[model samples]
Target chain A: MSEPESDSISKGKDGLTIHTVSKDRLLEFMKDMKERGFNHLSLITGVDRRDYVEVVYHLHAMDRDEYVVVKTTTDNGVVPSMTSLWNSARWDEREQYDLMGIKFEGHENLKRIFLPENWVGHPLRKDYDLSNVQYINMDEDGEDYATFDQGDGW
Target chain B: MNNFVELNFGPQHPSTHGVLRLRAKLDGEIVRELEPIIGYLHRNAEKLCELTFYADNLIFFDRMDYVASMLMESGYLEAAEKILNIPPPERVLWIRVIMNELSRIASHLVWAGAFGLDLGMLTPFFYCFAQRDYILDVFTEVCGSRQETNYMSVGGVYQDLTPEMIEHIDAFLQSFPKKLEEIYRLFVKNDIFISRNKGIGVLSKETAIDYGVTGPMLRASGVNYDVRKANPYLVYDKVDFDVPISQKGDNLARFLVRFEEMRQSVRIIKQAITKIPDGPFFNPKAKKSMMIRLRGDGEYYARTESPKGEFGVYIVGDGGVKPYRVRVRSPSFKNLSVLPVLAKDQMISDLISISGTIDLVFGEVDR
Candidate 1:
């Protein structure tokens, strides 16, 4: 984790190191990082790059103060879930899937978190439809569901 | 018939602070499992930050952790300033330290009062609020608003502390600790409080680290990682303060850790107020309009010791007035993730005791 041994890793001027891993290697790289004492999975987020979504991981070493970013882009919106290495990734990955529409391959509950399960396209995508109006209402089971029909309105 | 009864704790209950909903499975009076269902207050905050100008984004954070608005503003500003690469003068840094410490105390005071209410002790809530009123007065004098104090700006604070404001803070500092001592004697030493909180909902150190718990929750579990002590952003390294920790990893341990933290915050403020120098508050180069149209092309993650765990702002700037992407690493979100593990096999009444110590603030949790 100290020296950037491969071309995927680059250090920023502000001492922030960003390592780009392929989607297939994310879980393996994360397992190695956790073993090396980068046990804190600080954050997991995604950015819409128009053609693909780039997933970012902010990892921290608890014993020492080393913060590093591990990134991988997914054109098909699929990345191996790292819940095996750190359970903290569960909710964070759910958030990314909810907002940026990234798919975590092995996530047990890979469902929308913030928005309802029946909502339209992911809202954080760059070209997400803003003009389309949707509504939320409670069902007989007392669960909130999303709908597009005007009858679901107030 | 089902062996376990299904119950919904809240999206609107007094004990469960600010709109958090938990689905719990109960067998008789024991909680078998609990799943926290959040997003009752999710208002698309992160998405809005992307659309907002750098100048206007600070206020948006005010509503996130409203009880500790100053700390939230400071957390975001710490990241924004790093991206801008324009550190304010020496006086402003000290000012930030003082205000941040006071904010921490104020935030903890609110928690103390609410915790008392959760335990059905009404008198301590009033005493805690009375002490908190004094802290809010100082914030109102320094900034214009008490709860949503948009005092912090990029590169500097909006205004300097006047002499009258300084006197008010001094008076508050001199008398507040005595009142805090009264609160400690009333609650911490009370046999009933101990019986209610002791050894309830134990979260092991391994589980805490696995869930990325930070702030008092992490410290209470014996992991000593305070952003101030570890990273020393601002004048933290210059000022001397202790990071209080507990090894018990239980509800009472979290309570004791936070109580000790408030005392340490007082220590930090007392030193910062004396050491603060006279200088221009803002960096002259960072103008209002210039900040609005700022096109800083870089990314930085600023972690601040917020009242809640490791509150962070991860900013990605792309040569534009608005940030390309902004994500908040909210501590409550992570802290709440540990509920099922902790609440397993606990009594139903202990739910209040456990969540009270977990210190759920749904504004941050849902945002």
Candidate 2:
């Protein structure tokens, strides 16, 4: 098949306009859109599709009263960060890294935001084992206080 | 010689409010750099929602922004209703507007009181709380619960407004203005309060938009963007209210914006009460116990103007009872992200006032 359009815009199931941009041209597309009045970066999140991860950016053009969702799918779970373009993307990118394991290259601080630094696995990934539970006792002092169990609650 | 000392502000400090830890690098009393460490109250609300049915997740929405539970519930229910393609009756819409505006007032009342306490003024705290209690009383009368009211459902509200509840709310509307005026006299015009907050923690309009701040904080920076006005949902389009804006973009600006917003909310509520038609509050077809099945393979995002800011909910349905993915784009999370930027080069003492002005509720921030 011939190469699909690098930048394709479609209306989402809801009212938002969805724009799918190629990973390589994502930064350029976002910059162009921003210059075109999509100044507000409302939300940045990721969806784990089992086969691949989809990174989603919700942008709003305040003056024009327009909202758009820019998304890109990645098999390797890595995408370019938009922190250089919008400061709002920093915390959100870190969150996507923590929960969905989608790494954003060139992010200033890419680390687990909601979970501990020593967290073993991403919780939102489909392959992660939810039954494997770990409990940390903050009152106790050492490794003995932290316990891991399979399908058990303390 | 330059000496920079690292200091920890919260996760326990009273002024920090709700377990927010700020690791600040201080040179003498002035802050050089600050980092906010969050997630202490994280309950994995987004992760847990994926395992729940459409209607069952409404309660979890309440837990996120406990200060403004009704607004949180409204956002989630609106998103689910959109995905399921269910529009509630006119009466339900009118009642929802009334409740939402009332919740907005209540949330602002708490903020006003807490913010006063943060500024070292105890009298205004009691005065604002006294008024807030009256609002909570009305909530309890209507929903049988005050703060964490899981009253909103997928297609409509869980209960209808009774005449006694209407009378109670009317009484509140009549008396709240006097109390608000008293609060204004107590703090808003006070010189000490003004001096402390007038120019501290300034966030410019460009900076606010770049960092994606919303609600009063964004409006304080002179941005006339409010979800209710920008994109009206429910009966907000019909109601007449002004979106308050300030050019100062400082602590005082944020305070004044919220104060004016409370008056506007009252205006919306009063209009809603008069315009609400006599009809069924809920859609007759919406069953109480049936699992709400959304359209397959579709994603929906819905947002509402909460007391704090724009609370958006994104849900993906896969033709199943449970959602494929549920994400809460909480305003507190985004607003708190700008703290480090705002606190830079400010006195360490100013950090408390700045954080208080941001009006963070860690439940929403950590979720």
Candidate 3:
């Protein structure tokens, strides 16, 4: 699994090595990366590309203090989860799913972390309607519910 | 029939600290499974940063780690400056080190004091807060704010330190170590505190690395991975200091690591003062007007060792005044992700101790 991914490897202007891999091979590639001492999963972010969503993973080797950015593009906004490799991915993936609308396949509990379940649309998306303000109200069970009508809230 | 009691730890409880909610399933006093439900304070900070110019995001960055606003501002500025390719003058570099260290110490004071209150130690809370106010006074003198000081800019600082301000800082630096020693004795030597914290919430090195827990938490596990020492930035290469660590990896170890870090900050500030040179602090090219219209096309992640951990700001610019995307690698968010691992098989009371050791800042976590 640790073979030279020469075709996918490219250097960004930021001076970090980047590996651009397909969605299906991402998990295996990451598994190989973890084996090669990229033990620390620094941060995971998803950016809207208008047509397709690009997911970025910043990995670091603690002993060597080296870093690499792993990137994958998904037209459907679904990528394999790294939760199996790193426990911290569970929350980071959830955040991406919550805001950027990128779904992590095979995640344990992929739920909205920063917004209510009834939230209208992913706020980070470029097409997200920011003018339509959503308010929250707590019911008898103390669970928050998102509402579009202002009167229905607090 | 199962006797698992479901509990809501906090959306409002004092110990949970600042709108963080932990949904836990408890079998008597032992936690079975826990889910941390956040977003009460999520104001779409990342999304907001994407919409505004890079310079405009400084205030928003300050809000994320309000306790250590200067550190947040500095980290964000570092990344933005990298893309803009603005290397500040030597004097600005030394000033950055001084301000960043003071911010680290102030943040640790808040964490130490609030942590003591969680364990019902009230006197330390007042002592630590009173000590923290002096640091805030220095900040107020610099930027006229007690907490959220908008002092840092992209290439340099908004204002240079006056002579009176430097004397104030020197006086505080001279007197603060003895005060920190007093705070240390109050928490470290007490038998009750030791019994509560020692051997509790032991985070192994592998687990700490896997979860990306940086700063004192990782150091507590004997991982010598400080961003300052590992990849020195902004004159950190010039400063002399030790990266204190312990192999115990317990709650007390984490406490000692941060407590020691406060003293080290004092040491760094002292060195920075004498080494600082006289020069223009602000880069003329990156003035306010230029920052508003500054357009860069590239991506860079600038990480700094903030008080709590390794705080990084990743900026991707698309040849526009505003950044294409801004992602914050919040230390607390990553550290808090391993809560279940730390809280597992411990008494419910120990949960507070573990969390206190972890140092949860919900603004950064939820943002």
TM-score (0 to 1) of chain B for each candidate: 0.98, 0.97, 0.98
Model 3 chain B poorest ten-residue lDDT run: B288-297
Better of 2 and 3 by TM-score: 3
| Shift in Å, residue B187, candidate 3 | 1.2
lDDT of 3 by residue, A38-150 (tens): 88899998989899999999999899999999999999999999999988798889999999999899998999888888777898898887767787788899877786753
- lDDT per residue, candidate 3, B116-205, as tens digits? 999999999999999999999999999889887889988899899988999999999988999999999999888999999999999999
lDDT of 2 by residue, A1-154 (tens): 3322447878887877888987888998888878888888999879999999988899988778788898899999989999999999999999889988998999989998988776778888878877889776554444324457998631
Docking class for model 2 is: medium
Q: How do the residues B1-367 of candidate 1 rate in per-residue lDDT, one tens digit apiece? A: 4789999988888899988888999999999878888887887788888889887898789999999988899899888877777788899998999999998998898898899899999988999999999999898888878899999888889999877887888888999889999998889778989999988878888889999889899999988989998999889999898999999999889988999999999899888888889989998767787787666668888888898899989888887888888999999899989888888899999988888888878888878
**How accurate locally, in lDDT, is each candidate?**
0.87, 0.86, 0.89
Q: What is the fnat value (0 to 1) for candidate 3?
A: 0.85
C-alpha positional error of residue B217 in candidate 2 after TM-score superposition, expressed in Å:
0.3
Which candidate, 2 or 3, would have the higher lDDT against the true structure? 3
After aligning candidate 3 to the native by TM-score, how far in Å is the CA of B294 from where it should be? 0.7
Best-to-worst ranking by DockQ:
3, 2, 1
DockQ (Cα-based) for each candidate: 0.65, 0.76, 0.78
The residue-level lDDT of candidate 2 at A112 comes to 86
lDDT value, candidate 2, whole model: 0.86
